[model samples]
Target chain A: MPTIVVDVMPKAELLDPQGKAVTGALSRLGVDAFSAVRIGKRFELTVEGEVDDDVLATARRIADEILSNAVIEDVVAVEVVE
Target chain B: MPTIVVDVMPKAELLDPQGKAVTGALSRLGVDAFSAVRIGKRFELTVEGEVDDDVLATARRIADEILSNAVIEDVVAVEVVE
Candidate 1:
């Protein structure tokens, strides 16, 4: 079965406390290659059958409506994987 | 600054209750194109300089050791994004 992947990330303007905490932890652990860290979500939706236009459209709609919160997060990508 | 995106997903054998709930909700809403849904995490690490081999290595290490739990999750990808 094909799968649709949806990537959702917090708005760029908003503050990500979880990311900040991870950044601080990295610095404390002596991993300084990264300056900032932002966390997001990745959803894998398993399709029932072939990935057609209607399936892709449904995935997009779900990505925007249910997978992510529009006010704080954005649907960055919606791609199909075998 | 370049960003390294790390994708972490729940272990395939684990039962994902959250995903199950969402799947149920989707079916109840009349969206049945998908059969299963799995949730994961996406971490964006902002590098202070160019993404070199060493930076990529560090990101991979973090993705495995810090970003995700070995017992419950797997690091699926670590790619550089602009």
Candidate 2:
């Protein structure tokens, strides 16, 4: 089974409050090497059947419409890990 | 600056309701190749300074403590993408 890994990140123009909060917390934790931290979502999908062209298209559609918000996020397939 | 990527996923023994929901939705959407779907978190961190042992150690600590729940989620540093 192919495990499609989809990465969904907040658009660059949008302010990521969660990321900012994480950075601040990290700074307080004495790990002061990060200038910025962007938090995003990753989905690992194990399709039961062979991943054909149709499956790929469906995955793309899922990423864009279901997994992420098109307006606030940019969904990209990072890879097929397995 | 080096960008460190941390991936956090729910433990295998734990039931992932979100993943299950996604799988159901996919099946309903006519993309019935999935046995399961695992949703996780990805963090992209641009450390301001060089990534030394201390930085790495801190990153590990951050992953273990802040980024994920050690009991429920398994956190791993998947890559150091530039």
Candidate 3:
């Protein structure tokens, strides 16, 4: 079955405490190649049948409506994978 | 500066309660196109300088060791992005 992938990330303007904590951890651990770290969510929706136009549109709708919180997060990508 | 994106996904054998809850929510909302849903993590690491081989290697190593748990999660991808 084909799968639709949705990528959601926190708004760039918002502060990501989780990412900051990880960045601090990395700094303490002597990994300084990275200056900043941001975390996001990746969702994989498995389709029951072929991924057609309707299914893709439905996925997009759900991604924007149900999967992600519009105020804090943005749906970055919606792609299909075999 | 470039960014290294690392994707981490939970093990397929394990039961994902959050994913199950979302699946149920979708079903109740009359969205039946998807059969299953899995949630994962995406990390964006901002590099201080250019993304070289060493930086890529470090990103992969940190992805496996710190970004994800070996027992429950797998590092699916570690790629550089602009």
Query: All models: lDDT?
Result: 0.95, 0.83, 0.95
Model 2: which docking level applies? high
- In the range B1-82, model 1's lDDT, one tens digit per residue, is 8999999999999999889999999999999999999999999999997999999999999899999999999999999988
Supply every candidate's count of residue pairs whose N, Cα or C atoms clash at under 3 angstroms.
0, 2, 0
**lDDT (0-100) at residue B73 of candidate 1?**
98
Question: Across residues B1-82, which tens digit of lDDT does each residue of candidate 3 receive?
Answer: 7889999988999998889999999999999999999999999999987898999999999999999999999898899987
Q: What is the per-candidate TM-score for chain B?
A: 0.97, 0.90, 0.96
Which of the CAPRI classes, incorrect, acceptable, medium or high, describes model 3?
high
- Candidate 1: what's its TM-score on chain B? 0.97
lDDT of 1 at B81: 89
Q: Clashes in model 2: which pairs?
A: A33-B48, A48-B33
**TM-score for every candidate vs. truth?**
0.98, 0.90, 0.98
Worst 10 residues of 1 chain A by lDDT: A41-50
- Comparing 2 with 3 on TM-score, the higher-scoring candidate is 3
Candidate order by decreasing DockQ: 1, 3, 2
| Candidate 1 lDDT over residue span A29-58, tens digit each | 999999999999999999987999999999
Lowest lDDT 10-residue stretch of candidate 1 chain B = B15-24
